[model samples]
Target: MLPFYSLLLIATWLVPKYCLVQLNEPFLYISATTFKFVLTSTLFLTKLKMKMSKFVCFITKKLQNLSIFVNPFWIQICYFISVSSVGFLVLKVLKPRNKSFRPNDFDVFFMSVSATTVSSMSTLEMEVFSDTQLTVLTILMVLGGEVFVSVLGLHWLNSKFKKQETQNKVIDPLVVSVEDLRYKSSIRYLSYVVWAYFLVIHIVGSTMISIYMSLVSSARNVLKNKGLHLVTFSMFTTVSTFTNCGFIPTNENMIVFSKHSGLLLILIPQILLGNTLYPPCLRFLIWVLWRLTKREELNYLLRMNFSDGIGYNHLLPFLHSCLLVVTVFGFIVIQFILFCCMEWNSEALKGLNCYQKLVAALFQSVNSRHTGESVVDLSIISPAILVLYVVMMYLPPYTTFLPRKNDEQSLRSNEKMKKRREKLVENLLFSQLSYLAIFIILICITEREKLREDPLNFTVLNIVIEVISAYGNVGFTTGYSCERQLKHDGYCKDAWYGFSGRWSNEGKLILILVMFFGRLKKFNMEGGKGWKLM
Candidate 1:
């Protein structure tokens, strides 16, 4: 009965999205599923909570034993929205008037995996390739970003609401310090600003790519012919990749002279976003506003930390973000220098004047660290570069995942993050190279096809992609080949992604083994009471 109740509730939210897609745009229903889930879930959750205290109490208590289940409820809800939408979308494509199904599991899994990792692979690339693919990727990447930010926002909302509930009276402020995402008060206004910032960056990045296209296209002056899809593609690609959606639209086809700034723009933002720099920026803006308005209370509010008496942590989070960007940047730079000096064929680079070589350097600089979208041929790169790639791919950039002890007990998880960066970078300097050497040899020798396949098997290549995408959750497939050719019974993804980019089956098994190790990783030294004597 309990299982049945849960299933029914889930189905109620998703049934409309499935039917809606089947009714209209039936061909692209899976593509519509994620958003539709968001829409329907919002509606269902609203109605479920409306004057339904009994149902609420039933759910709240029944799930109390499973705190972890409830903890990630939002993630589950978001994922449910994402997966149901994809199912509807696939059905629309197969268009089963009677019910013969083509179970394209990889396509939908890739969609969910890509969204979770903020990657850019699409069934379209494996099917009828079009620029609209970028738009789909863009939406997924934004949802990924939204999930991260919303979780951060919820941390605030839960605390505030808990306090109010205890007092048994609402102390409402005209400008709320925090609210649910839908509530949109002045405090939540900052979230809107964050959204706008990302949108503008997406547009600017796309526009730059478009300009590059305009310069290189033979039909340069013809605005009517260039098409909005390209602009849309470029913008979405920029934000998608920046937000860590590793999908692409304009592949090897590029406007040689338009400007390579789009590539640079896309690359920089990954570092920026990966570092999660928005909170500090928001804090800065609040400080400026307080000073400008001459509001002492505003200044006091700014000074407050999540827990009492813990003062402002100005440099810790910034430094954490800096180390993350720097480590990735530095590692990728070494990879380029080594690859070019040791592996790159002399003939290709030899003919270049300093300027052309310089541009190629710029290209190399942007793509290697953040994404696997090498403008040049990946198959041709030196074995060492490929080996370097495997090493870089394993870095999971999360503030919460690493060691936590000795860390400051601040709500800003970034402090512990900074400490972990120091440890990983330091370990890499000493022991990681040998360990990486052994791992690389295993990959190259054991995974023969990853190295030797011409147009790599979509299934096999997905393993390579999954390994890389897991760390940063960026999904990009180099233009090695279209996925349809690599499909084995339409389930190449089963073959392609080896355990869902290290977030899946074998990866979890490996983690379970590692958990037995006596000590878990710890963070920055607390000095008895970090930033406090409390």
Candidate 2:
């Protein structure tokens, strides 16, 4: 048992290091291979079997005792906070690209939280970050992404099931129910599917982006001029887009590459696959598996129940999944039409030709939903379009247009609805809007001077948009401009950052909490139901 435990710890440390290193690093490969060989050799030692069994039982009993406090919501919150803290420390130690620029401690911490939550809210320019800082951000975004987090959750569930099975085997094998077995099998299958989805999209997306940048001299030159490596830019953009984080390597975001319609086209699918279109895509994948393998577990996974037969919420019914696809596209089309009509002759699209404008409009429309990657200055866009973008950002990623069920189906679902309502605690008294209003008010107080002096730039509408964007975990903002200030002072200087970058320390702190709240908003989806106005 001692030998096995020691080897397990060593393996865990070596495996992660090995994975992070390049293939050209043969020393790590040899170390990993040697560790694996030694671990396997020790596993076959018959003398340790009895001790190992005893240790397993001891650990299982301890875990069972401690399981009462293991809430998934708290686990997720802690995960984000822990990752953010680590990122902050790493960024603090790493030197910035610009030797003269030294960001405030609060801003560095804010950037860490923003990246960890995939919110993309910035208080500093993107180019100021060294390549190491960018890599750290890339890692944070990938780890914080919805798809990657879901995969981690699936892995946790699978391990929990395995532990339960082990305990049942040791205590009473017959206690394991048929339903439990089916559920466990389904979780394992879903875990595999999610992992495949995450890996395949990243691999394909990065590869395509790399190839496009190579062929397109204009795109390649943008990175070269900025002193960015082609591979780093490709991987960073791919991760950011797929995660819907919107934190591009360049300060201007997608605006710098607005003319690269091909690049925008390449990213559109990646954005959808990672966010709004995920549920439908997952359902389709399971359906395809059901078709190929004709497996009962996959079929059970595709069930129309809200619980999805396996306790996974994302796997929607066939009808609901189809409706979600239509609803998402419908929103995109509406945004595209309005943006094109309003901004067609505006300065935002002035330099671009008609085709470029169309592609840029489509890209902006898609990003307005959650990605937050913009092709044009959002501040310069029409107020009407900005309002539309705000609404789009406020809506949840899985917002779908589900048709009313027939009488019989409605009757059948009533019991489930009642059960769900019964689980909602009265303590969750505030709605999502209520929280947003409170944040907006706090921000206004913090930025009260700015609001008064620069009414045009710091209008209530702009404040509302910024607050909603933070609460929605979308990074869209009516960015600050010294030009828009009513009375321009010598102190007023424009910085290449988001609107929130111009916010005071107190306001920035408030938005940091908003980003955290938004990231964990799934846990409180039914919150504020107890305080319904109706």
Candidate 3:
């Protein structure tokens, strides 16, 4: 660790200096931070891809030979931890030189882990970081989230694609089996299109945001003479937004762009599409469209042979997609109705017109689903709404979002499948509630003294919101920036909303553990759900 840390320090110190000089030249192609982000993202992605490939091969060969079983839940857990550890170390090595305020080592590590987990909790203000460090953080967000895992799935999918291609060349042209067709369709629709889809969205989204920023002098000036193109802001915003990692270029977050409807339009779609169940949803959507259009070429490409009856296996992805859609839809509707019924005239939504209020409701509802970007200060919301948020975050529906095909060919009974699904849901809910209890308890015990000293700021409600945010990995806060509090020898007089920036080291450690556990549990439980669905 010593040698590795030394090498990282040397690189971090030297690389920026060299790149700064190069970037000063008029003809240079890219900024240093962007270059670092690209280089690091590529490196991590390649390593992860190779590891996944080797693991898959090992499972197919060695594990099968030994007649031993290894659960995907454990495999996913290991993958998450390994990638996150590397990501944290990289952030530590590439620590920012631009001192907004000097951050302790734990702050950087916490941010790195949060980004890797795709949980966007911030322990420090984001605006203080150097561009190079911020770019690294953005890359970590993308790589740490669904994008990296999806790419690994694509690596396995490549072999599946080749196998299907070979099968397509068969002279008999027998009807494709349900499983074969599902794989082929998923590969064609998801594997092939997902990257292109993201690229197109990024280009369009960044353009929209940059254009909006240009119209605002405050945002435009931030990019001025910084060797950052107008598009750079867009790129960073696009990636972070789509990954649902709640990082913002500014410390104030989306509050600065609260009135910007164009930005909202771009963000909402990205958040919706980035939901954990999107891949499976996409597969089902394409399948439906092919059926509606009766496009022979599409059907041929997807290798869809519908001669056999559509089995429950074929419908699982579609069912999962439908459930996700309903879940999000139901949540938004319910939240909006409550907002109207309860806090219609509250300061949070007071000045806004009816239309703006509705839009605000929609945004907050979507955001509550762990998207983390906030347009409104959460502190002012009624206790009822806050309670609703706690519930939404603690038990996000994405925990059971992706379903895989079952291997119960021997006992093809609908009754058995129904029972299995019920059991799976029971286990998921139980685990989530249990974890939530543990997090809340730990936070309470750790912050007892702090709560006593500053009851107003560290009230029970504030503690609950903060704990849920940490456990849910959502970064929404009432504004308790604790960096100042922790720095001073005495308690700070400021009423900055949100959790402790000034918390004891022990308190911060509890939040860190909760955040990590939340992220790790998400992947493990979600993957386990998919396995059970199969």
- What TM-score would each prediction reach against the true structure? 0.53, 0.84, 0.69
Q: Count the backbone clashes (under 3 Å) in each candidate.
A: 16, 0, 13
Ranking 1 against 2 by lDDT, winner? 2
Error of 1 at 261 (Å): 5.8
lDDT of 3 by residue, 220-271 (tens): 5655744345544666677777777777766667765566555676687777
On a 0 to 100 scale, what is the lDDT of residue 83 in model 3? Answer: 59
Each model's lDDT comes to 0.42, 0.81, 0.61
Backbone collision tally, model 1 = 16
lDDT at position 516, candidate 2: 95
CA lDDT of 385 in candidate 2?
98
Better of 1 and 2 by TM-score: 2
Native-vs-model 1 lDDT? 0.42
Please report the candidate that would top TM-score against the real structure. 2
Off by over 4 Å in 3: 1-70, 95-97, 157-189, 216-229, 276-281, 288-316, 349-355, 399-430, 481-500, 522-534
The candidates, ranked best first by TM-score, are 2, 3, 1
Candidate No. with top lDDT: 2
Candidate 2 structure quality by residue, lDDT tens digits, 1-534: 767667685775578356547455655554554444334333432333345335434544544444568766766787789889999999999999997889999999999999989899999899999998998898889878988677655655666787778999999989999988887898788877876777667767877787677667799799999999755687788889999998999988888999999999999999999999999999889889889999988887876476333556676677777888999999999999999999999989989998999999999999988889988998888999999988999899988766646432344344545665444543445778888889888999999998888898888998898888887878987788998878877898887788988888999999999999999887766556567465
Q: Given candidate 1, what's the lDDT at residue 56? A: 28
